[model samples]
Target: MTEGDSPMSSIFAAMAPVPERTIADATTLDAAIRAADTPFVVRGLVLDWPLVQAGLKSAQAARDYLAAKRKDVAFTVSVGEAGSNGRLFYDDAMAMNFRVGRGKLPDIFGHIASIENQPDAPPVYLASIDMDGFFTGLADENHVDLGDRDLLKSIWIGTRTRIAAHNDFPQNLACCAVGRRRFTVFPREQFRNLYLGPIDNTPAGRAVSMVDFHDPDFQQHPRFGEALAHAQMVELEPGDAIYLPSLWWHHVEGLAPFNVLVNYWWRDTPRWLGQPQDALNHAIMSIRELPADERAYWRDMFDYYVFGDPELPRAHIPEGAQSVLGPLTADSAGRLRGFLLRQLSK
Candidate 1:
């Protein structure tokens, strides 16, 4: 049989494994999040939630449930022509392939209600609306009690749609609240094989893979075959959830005519550590085009000074004299930031 026709167990057997763990309730979910270093599926984690109950009744019931909680707040929604077949991607010339506009929460819900059952309808997505900001009580009604007050809770509502493969900076808990959803995930090390798009100007907020998952042109993106070999697929039913570690690439597909997904994102890093993307951008600007030998030398330097044991580098130096290379407190981080600003000014 062809690879496409092979059983899922056979396909997954060929690739690296993604584990599945069952957590009985929300309390256990918090522990799982803290302990899990890899991506995992949590079966029926939110099955008892009221939102899931409403969704199980009917799509209309779910819509009404959301509408009742929405406080007339406006959020951005993405619209694409029906011709695109729900894939949000780029055209031949590499322009944004869809239109994004602002609309109210209730209005978007009405739009979903009007077209949900139609056999042919344009893709409409209320992508990544902050749930706590727009629907104030929604988090309280249905939520993951991770106990992190700063955790970001967001809502995704859309018609049948496919989001291109992309990575996020924070740890993600994507809960399928209303409809079935599919996720194809790849480990962070597969970055090169994914045929990623431009870093600076992205179709979505994050840089997405240029290689379309539905109909990848193997001739143009041959490495994508390698990526596919390593992919792990999961189908999440209503109330199922998946934990995606930071930097894991994922492609998402909404299987139903209308879908509502609730996601929580947070970082364990200290606030002073800042974003690693900034350092990556600086490295690209300063080091990417350097000679091979110089690049190798810098790589070794980074391995030793940055990724190596923090104590190893500063063990011999006096605490007061260690400067930027020593333990980083808020004051030291501020000084380092000032130093970087001065360097950039030149």
Candidate 2:
């Protein structure tokens, strides 16, 4: 992709720059990540990796390196038609514009390479494939050590494509393994202005902003301009990486014909803890349709029970009679799940 290929090129001067950190190695990287509460760029973070070296040589070399490392397993891939302009998103009727099917690494790479130089090429994306699951030793060979923390390490390979703004529950460290990428980010508070799409019926797993960053329809989504006011943009070259805190919204753009990114996503909380999104989904079903007065009452109740002072709930109740109001352990969590399931069944 060229300079004018992305909308960020035109509005680049207006957006705030994401902060940068100079991390020397994996240990320092881990420390920096633990300390970060916001997104920041890290230049040359993985410049010494052999995979980075192969990519710097050429896209073909990168492809060859991946093919040699990957296991002979078919992975799910998404392909957008030519007119979609590299956007893997929903159509006017809320149907996805892209087609998804399974393909092996080598065949997918070959197809991506075949249309690499075309001006109006279709977008082909191999997204969020678990590195260790599909590749024999690629994860160990091309990786940044983040201590012994349990992590979900995934790889994304694709041509020039636009991913709509979406937020993740886990903190992310995304490395530009090959080619180039530009990220347009918004804080979690910008949710009201982003004009998010349907949560249940989404193109990808996450709910994304409805606005098209390339050619934003201001008349339709006027508040998106406000979202841009709080937006920050960062462009990463090969071997560069960026860290994003949990719940921060990001719109990603693949700027090269054969771009690849490797990202690690992990939450700070215990794995046994319930997902917050599930609670939110249940709230929408149970609380959203209530009468205005009843809803307001529930809001206050939630504020007191869920978001209020932790100590306040147990302060008045006897220590022995606190039950679910007290501290939750793995056993308590399992009982709570069972109770909720029984209640739902009724």
Candidate 3:
């Protein structure tokens, strides 16, 4: 069949298009990150990185380059049976459907090499290994010049893998090092329509949408149609990168026999500010199941205290007496934590 007539093409034709922004160098990238409002694709930025050069030669050469830089540290790798079809997802019982095995970098690389030529090999993924800890000098060769910010760099290596749609806490920059990839992103506002699975029990590190992108069961997850209407897609080449804003829901597909991706994750939140996810968990326990009238009261309280004006609430109270209502600093946060622990205990 022709490209336009293909099933995948028909599916993609329905979703919103993701915008692409070509960044020339590190200076342009810095400007983009400073104004981080939406997701954008960066092309030609990492064309000169050594890893990209390695990938251009061959997949084996790329593997060799990474294997040469391997350190003696153990990291977790996800192993899925061939039957799973490269998608790391939940089983029928809503439990995680993959096995995690600890392996060193070289061993993982060797496993990837072994399955390189297999027609129907099982999905073996060395997912999210920290670049700084294991592949020490690798970053020096292919790193983003984010200046003084403490950015976490991680690598994802796998063969034709699919990671379910999930939102991350930090802003992300995923650079394709050795193969092509397709990223389907949706705005945070599309959360309700995305049909997210269990929050407490997740397949991967984060809660994933139950609706499968490859073959979505509309009967079971009918609301997912609305999510698709608001979706955006981007395809990345070896040297391409995509910047995802914090809390943007993204579904990732590694589209080659042997794929390697390097991602940088960072957030602009202050260290003194407590994790918003923690507050979400607390709300789930305390507020989620409350009666509508009681929840409505809490909503107004949140608007007045947490979501609304910060300085206005403490305008009357003395600075020292403001306690948890005041600005969050190391001492104030500690006291608030203790107060929360006491409340939870009760």
- Candidate that would win on TM-score: 2
lDDT of 1 by residue, 225-322 (tens): 78888798888899998999999999898988888899999888877878888898899999999999999999988988999888888899998899
Q: Model 2: per-residue lDDT, tens digit, 36-109?
A: 88899999988878888999999999999999999988989999989566888998889998899998888998
Report, for every candidate in turn, its global Cα lDDT versus the true structure.
Answer: 0.84, 0.89, 0.84
**1-346 per-residue lDDT for model 3 (tens digits):** 3224544566876666678886767788889878877898887668889989999999989988988888877878988867555788887887667789898777887888888668657788888888878876999999888777779999998888889999998889999988888899999999999888877888766878988777778899898888888889988899888999999999998878889999998878766566787898889999989999999999999999988999988999998899888878888888888888899899
Can you tell me which runs of candidate 1 are displaced by over 4 Å? 1-18, 291-297
What TM-score would each prediction reach against the true structure? 0.89, 0.95, 0.93
Query: Candidate 1, 71: how far from true, in Å?
Result: 2.5
Alpha carbon lDDT at 81, candidate 1: 73
Report the alpha-carbon TM-score of model 2 versus the true structure: 0.95
Error of 2 at 27 (Å): 3.7
**Which candidate's lDDT is highest?**
2
Prediction 3 global C-alpha lDDT: 0.84
